[model samples]
Target: MDLNLRKAILSNISENDHKQLEATIVDAIQDGEEKMLPGLGVLFELIWEQSDDQDKQEMIKSLEQGVQQANTGS
Candidate 1:
């Protein structure tokens, strides 16, 4: 995940939950090294479940903008 996505997620979650989620994500990332696609799917599901609709939309928009910037830069 990009910094923007991580920032958005952290912004929305409570401090306590954020720490727990961070640990969970770190563990998942380590596990994901052996199974990348599945690990990514799990990460997405975890983020999506914790996020509200507005945050989801914001993340999508941020990603879209990033793609556009990259395309234009190229």
Candidate 2:
């Protein structure tokens, strides 16, 4: 099977308002299902592509901190 998940997800949600987008992301995270990961990855890819270098650096730093915290269970 050949499916363009990112393209399909983007197409489906492109017209969603800000609140709807926020709700979708929050729900996906709160649900804690493995299946939602690819959607989150697609969203992250979109954000990474659009972000400036400084913003990207900040995001990386935040992610590193999150990883560190998770590992330390803090």
Candidate 3:
């Protein structure tokens, strides 16, 4: 069976309110389970698609900073 993971993930969370969506992300990150990564990636994909260029640039900057911080443990 072929699984459309992005569609499946979006379908599951489509009804979530803003707070619920935030909680879902927080909980998933806190849980730190490998299974949650795909859902997060799908969510980020949705955000990236919806973001304007400025928003995307800001997100990229934030992510770059975060990755650097994580790598340097600072």
In order, the Cα lDDT scores of the candidates are 0.69, 0.94, 0.97
Mark the regions of model 1 whose C-alpha exceeds 4 Å error after superposition. Answer: 1-37
TM-score of each: 0.44, 0.94, 0.95
Tally clashes: model 1: 0
Which segments of model 3 are wrong by more than 4 Å? none
Judged by whole-model lDDT over C-alpha atoms, candidate 2 comes out at 0.94
On the 0 to 100 scale, the lDDT of residue 60 in model 1 is 93
| Residue 24 accuracy (lDDT) in model 1 | 58
- What lDDT tens digits, residue by residue, belong to model 1 across residues 1-74? 34565455445444646677677568766776754455455557777899999999998999899999989995
Q: Tell me, by lDDT, which candidate is best.
A: 3
Give the Å error, residue 39, model 3. Answer: 0.3
lDDT of 1 at 51: 100
TM-score, model 3 to reference:
0.95
> Alpha-carbon error at 30 in model 2, in Å?
0.6
Better of 1 and 2 by TM-score: 2
Cα deviation of 55 in candidate 2 (Å)? 0.2
lDDT head-to-head 2 vs 3, winner = 3
